[model samples]
Target chain A: MKLTILGCYAATPRSFTNPTSQVLEVKNHLFLIDCGEGTQMQLRRNKIKFSKIRHIFISHLHGDHFYGLVGLISTFRLLNREKELHVYGPKGIKEIITLQLKLANSWTNFPLLFHELNSKEPQLLFEDSAVMVKTIPLKHRIYTNGFLFQEKPGERKLLINEAVKYNIDVSLYNSLKKGKDVVSEDGELIENHLVTADPPPPKSYAFCSDTVFDPDIVPQIKHVNALYHESTFLESEMDLAFPTKHSTAKQAATIAKLASVKKLILGHYSTRYTDINLFRQEAETIFPNVDLADDGAEIIVE
Target chain B: MKLTILGCYAATPRSFTNPTSQVLEVKNHLFLIDCGEGTQMQLRRNKIKFSKIRHIFISHLHGDHFYGLVGLISTFRLLNREKELHVYGPKGIKEIITLQLKLANSWTNFPLLFHELNSKEPQLLFEDSAVMVKTIPLKHRIYTNGFLFQEKPGERKLLINEAVKYNIDVSLYNSLKKGKDVVSEDGELIENHLVTADPPPPKSYAFCSDTVFDPDIVPQIKHVNALYHESTFLESEMDLAFPTKHSTAKQAATIAKLASVKKLILGHYSTRYTDINLFRQEAETIFPNVDLADDGAEIIVE
Candidate 1:
């Protein structure tokens, strides 16, 4: 799995920095998160293929988080895209997009799908053969929900050499790979564990931003491979964080430490600070595995 | 009066080129026209103060035309703006903007006024002491309208020495400036032409884009100081331009030549061509005063 940070700065887009947006690549799937303005330009700069994007997850409807969505959708139609695109976001997104389409008098030729989340509790929002995404209910000023992307466990690998020595039927191998015990024609019992090896360990990632220093979400995102949380302020600006429903770097580290995530990626820094090294230093003081996100930077998950 | 081209290319935003957007500075007012994506960065690069912009005009709802508006509005709020902003565009703008504000739970502290246009006939949208803007209906796939900005005719200026020798009263001077014959206090008939000279001719600029070669709009913008029209293709691609509701370089010049405009600015070239000089050559073949629009280039009206 790999992750690319398109923009990490908070508040607004400037010539030097941009707002929140990123791309996560896992198992032949590219998932987009929080598409701020200029995200399409950032995608082109990083040489990411436009067609690889099939699913988009929006954390909230803040301009910095998902304002680029309508533009991206229009670009897709202008490019004559044929593949269907799926979008999972908060409720009222469909209405907003449709209204713009009405005024523009332009509609997409491809199928546009929307899955709106209006619940307050954590629920399964999306699932397929390779991946499943669950909502991680977060405490915020509005109806906001974080997403947890977990790689579903795959089929167990067959112990081919051992199965051949046992003279097992090739047709029975399919059932054995599914962790089921099979009976041979000679009335011999073959254990599933002995015939198959364990599959690769599942990896997961959770994205949460624009939330306060709430630990209630710890249980939902416990022990994941990587976690991206908003650190819009620093230790000095702790007073402003809570009132604005934002998080500081130290507060983000505290959550990362409690959740025991393998790696913590901190982003969404305020534009008031010219330099960002202080964010890394502040987050690393609490969480040793913390890394500051830079615009256009890529991180590999091995 | 001065005009700066932020982006003038035709199609989607490429890695290097951009789409339609510009800044018109007239009478100490900054008017943003068709804010495409990356306009914020372009503003920064051009050293334009954000506070000076009090008005924004969107020609259409196409993504390339006005996709950057929501982000720009959010940025203004983030920067703690206090000035009232007026946005003039087609209908449905209110829905898209309010949805973002509702989801973020943070609305602008300053007042935001909108003038949504859904009219088929030409109408006056905005007028002040110095400037007046009228709609110019154009033919496109969508309901699009171009803007014509004409400097209002000012009061005639009286030569101070010439009027003083004639013993003209201050109150009578007002009538002289208005180009009206006034009777002096001594009952002497005063000729308005002898007391004052004619004011400089009012300058005007017309912007017409994202339209086809209809030539019906010539009467609306005839004999203007400058006219900017979209030329999305060269003469070789004229066949495609008609079906797509775009214009070729020669077609744009045909309108300019028929209207006898002072100057003609051509823009909105398709991305298929790497060179832009061909457009200028094509337009100049028909019109003597023709120039191509490029990003960051400015035109100063003398």
Candidate 2:
């Protein structure tokens, strides 16, 4: 799995720093997350193919989180895109987008689907043979959700030499890979574990942002391979974070530590701070495996 | 009057080229015209003060023309702008803006006034002691209007030497500047023309865009100092221009010639043609005084 941060700053997009947006590539799916203003330009700058974005996930209704969505939809129409697009966002997302398109009198030529999520509990959003996506409810000023993407475990590996030694027929290879015992040609039973090896463990990624320090979500995102959490303010501004329902670096680190995530990625830094390294330093005090999310930075999950 | 082209391309904003947006500064008023996507970045890049903008004029409801407006409004709120903002656009603009704000639950602290324009004829949109703005109806696929900004005539410059020779009292200088013949203290009538010259001809700028080859608006923008007309296609694509309700360079120049404007500025070029010089060449064929509108290019009305 690969993750690319198109923008990570907070509130508004600056000339150099963008707002919140990212691209996650997992299991043949390119998912766009939190398309803030200027996200289309950021996508182009990052060299991400526009046509590859089949699904979009908006965490909340904040302007900095989803303002670029309508523009992207319009651009798709202008580019004559024909592929169906799916958008998973808050309840009012469909209304906002439809109103703009109605006013402009330019509707999409392709199918535009909306999945309005308003569940308070973790709910499955999408599932396929290769991957599954679920929502992690978060505490914020508004109704928001974090998405968890998990790759499904593959079939067990086949040991051809062990299967041949057991005199197992080649036609039984599929059964062995499915972790089933195969009957030998001499009517003897062979255990599947003796012929096949276990597959590698599946990896998962969790995206959480624009939320306060909430331990309630820890159970939902536990043991994810990588976690992206918003650190809108520093520890010095903890008081401000409470009122705004945003998280500080230390708060995000605490959550990561509680969830026991393999790696913690911090972003959504307030524009007031000129130095971003402070966030990493503060997060490392509690969680050693912490990385700062920067625009165009790519991370690979092993 | 100063005109700054923040962006002047047709349709979607590219990595390098922006969409349609500009700043017209007249009589101490900074008016934003057609704020396309990524206009705020352009404003920052051009060093244009955000606070100086009080009025925004949107020609139409096309995404490329007004998609950046809500983002700018949100940014203003984030910046804690206390000044009132006025937006002029098509009838459905208020609903579109209010819906987004309602969805985000972020209402502006300052007043946001909307002037919805649905008239099919010329109408006054804004006016003050120093400047006047009126809408010029245009022919397009959607309801559209081009704005004509005219500077009111300023006080005539006083010829101090001539005033002294005429023995005009200093207290009556203000009256003379208003083009009134002053009565001297000795009961002598002082001629205003002999002591003062007529104020420099009031400069006007007409912005007509996203329109087809229609001569009906010529009289409304006639004799303006500068005319910015959309030339989305070249003469080679005249066939395509008609159906799209867009104009070719030659058609824009034809309108400029009919209107007898001092200079013609051609913009809103389709991204298909890379050579922008071709637009100027084609426009200058019919109108000798033609200028091309490029991003960050500034024009002074003399």
Candidate 3:
């Protein structure tokens, strides 16, 4: 799985900095997460194709989180996109977008689908044979949700040499890969494990942003391959974090340590700071495997 | 009068080019015109203070024209602005912006006054001691209005040497600057023209965008010092201009000539063109003093 940070800044978009927006490429799916203002431009700057994005997940209705959504939707229409577009966000997102479209009188020619989410409990948002996406309910100033993307396990790998040595027929190779016992050409039963190796472990990534440091989300995001958490402030500004419903770098690292996530990526830095390395320095005190996210940065999930 | 082009391209905003948005600094007023996406960032890039912008004029409901208004408004609130903001646009603009603010629950602390307009004829929108703004109805796909920002005549320049030669009292200088004749202390009648020169000719700037090749607006914008007109297409693509309710460079030049505007500024070019100078080349065939607008280009209204 690969993740691209299109924009990671907090609050307002600046000339050189952007707000919250990213793209996760997993299992042949390109999921756009939290499109803020100037997201479309960031997507263009990152050289990401606009048409590949089929699903857009918005965490909340905050301007910094979803202001670019309507513009992106309108651009898709201008590009003559015909594929269905799915938007999953807080309950009022549909009304906010539809009203703008109504006023502009430029509705999309393609299928525009809106999935308004208001569930407080964790719920599955999307699923297919290859991937599953679930919501990690988050506590914020308003209704918000973080998304968890998990890749499904692949088919078991067949060991051709071991299968040949076991005298298993080639036609039964498919059954062996499915982890089922198959009859050999010599009429002997062959165990699936004897001829096939287990597939690589499935990768998972969790995106959490614009939320206060809450240990409650640790259980939901536990043991993920990669976790992206908002670190709007550092330890120096700890007093301003909770009241604003944002997380400090140390607080994000504490959650990462409690959840045992394999890797913790910190982002959503406030523009007030001149040096972003301070966040990494602060988060490293709690979690050793911490990575700082910047605009246009790309990460590979292990 | 100074005009800063924030984003002058037509249609969707791109990585380097922006949609329609510009800042006109006239008579101590920083007027934002046609705020598209990425406008606030552009304002920052141009080093224009957000608090100085008390008035915003939106040409239409097109996404490219006003998508950045809500974000700019929200950013104002974030900056703790207490000054009232006045928005002038079509009737539906208030609903479009208010709904988004409602959904985000981030209403502005400052007074946001919306002047919704639905007039087909030229109507005065704002008037102060220094400036007067009126609508120049434009023909587009939807209800749209261009704005004419006219600088009110300044106080007459009192020729100090001439006033002293006439033995006029210093206390009467204010009245002399107001173009009034005053009786000299020596009982001599001094003519206003003898002591004071006429105030500089009132400078006027008319902003016309996203409109077809309509001649109806010529009279309203006639003899303006500067005219910023949309030239979304050149003569080569003139076929696509009128059908899309846009004006070609030649068409804009023709209107400039018809209106007898002092200077013609060609902007809102379609992003498909590689060279924007072609717009000036085309417009110059019909009218001289044509300036091509780029993202950060600044023009002084002569």
Candidate 4:
């Protein structure tokens, strides 16, 4: 699994920095998260194929989080896209996008789908044979949700030599990989474990941003392979962070330590802080594994 | 009058090229016109003072023309703006803007006033002691209007040396500047023309974009000091231009020639064309005075 950060700044986008937006690639799926303004340009700058984005997950209704959405939808229609696009966001997201399309009198020719979400509890958002996605309800000034992406456990690996030693027929290899006991040609039952080995462990990523220091989410995202949490301010600015319902670097590190995530990626930095390394230094005091997310930075999940 | 081209390219914004948006400074007032995506960053790149912009004029509801507006508005609130902002655009603009603000629950602390226009004929949009703005109806795929920013004729300049030579009292200089004949302290009648000269001819600029080669605007924008016209295609692509309701370079020059504009500025070039100079060459064939608008190019109206 790999993740690309298109933008990681807080508040407004500036000439040198952008707002929140990123792309997560897992199991051949590219999922776009929090399309802030200038995301399409950032996508182009990073050479990411626009066609690869089939699903977009929005965390909230803040302009910095989802303002680029309508423009992207319009560009898709302009480019003659025919594939259906799915959007998962807050409840009012559909109304906001449809209103702009209606006013411009430029409706999409392709099928546009919107999955409005306003639930306060964790709920499954999407699931397929290879992967599954669910919400991690977050505490913010507004109704918000972070998404959890996980790769489903795969079928057991077939041990070809062991299967042959067990006198298993080639046609029954599929059943053996399915962890089922198979009857040999001589009417002898062969245990599936004798002919197959365990597959590689699956990986998971949890995305949580624009939220306060709420421990409620720690249990939901516990022990994820990677966790991206918002660090909008430093511990020195704790006074500003709480009233604004944002998290400081120390608070984010505390959450990371409590959840026991393999790695913590810090992002959504307030532009006022000139030195981002200060966050990493502060976070490392509590959490040993900390990574700072910069625009265009990519992380490979291990 | 000074005009800064923040972005002039047509269609979607790319890493190098931007969509429609510009900054016009006339009579000490800064006005933002057609805020496409990334406009705020463009404004910062251009070193424009955000507080000076009290008015924004949108040509149409197309994504490329006004997608950046809401973000700019939201940024104003985040920056703690206290001044009132007036936005003039098509009829549905209010609903489009208000809906997003409502959904985000980020109403601006400053007053935001919207002026919706649906007139088929010319209408006055704004006026002050120094400048006046009006709408120029244009034929496009949607209800669109071009803006005419004209500096109201100023009070006649008081020629200080001439005024002293005419023996005009200091107290009467204001009257002399107002084009009033004044009685000198020596009991001599001084004609206003003898002491004062006409102020620099009131300069005017017409912004016409995202429209086809419609001649109906010729009479309205006739003889303006500078006219910025959309040239989205070349003469070779006239077929596409007409179908898409856009104009070619040659067609834009034809309108400029017909309107007898003092100078013609061509912009909104289609990004498909690598050579923008071709637009200038084609336009120069029809009009003697032509200027090509680049993303950061600035023009001074003389």
Q: How far is each candidate from the true structure, as Cα RMSD in Å?
A: 3.5, 1.6, 1.2, 1.6
Writing each residue's lDDT as its tens digit, candidate 4 over B205-284 gives 99999889999899999999999999999999899998889999999999999999999999999888999999999999
Candidate 3 C-alpha lDDT tens digits along B1-302: 99999999988988888989999999889999999999999999989987899999999999999999999999999999999999999998999889888888778999999999999998999999999999999999999999999998999999999999889899999998888899998999999999888888999999999899999999999999999999999999988987899999999999999999999999998988999889999999999989988999999997
Query: Candidate 2 lDDT, tens digit per residue, B36-81?
Result: 8888888888999987799999999998899899989999999999
As for candidate 4, its clashing pairs are none
State residue B50's C-alpha deviation in candidate 4, in Å.
1.3
The number of clashing residue pairs in each candidate reads 0, 0, 0, 0
lDDT of 1 by residue, B166-258 (tens): 777878888888899887667788898878888888888889988999778999999998999999999898889989999999999999999
Better of 2 and 3 by DockQ: 3
| Structure candidate 1, residue pairs in collision | none
Per-prediction DockQ: 0.62, 0.74, 0.83, 0.83
Evaluate model 1 with DockQ and give the value.
0.62
Whose TM-score is greatest here? Answer: 3
DockQ (model 3, Cα): 0.83
Segments of candidate 3 deviating more than 4 angstroms = A167-170
Report i-RMS for every model: 1.5, 0.9, 0.8, 0.8
For residue B275, model 2's alpha carbon misses the true position, in angstroms, by 1.6
Candidate number that wins on TM-score, 1 or 3: 3
lDDT of 2 by residue, A11-130 (tens): 988777888999999989999988998889888888899888899999999988998999999999988999999999999999999988988877999899999999999889889998
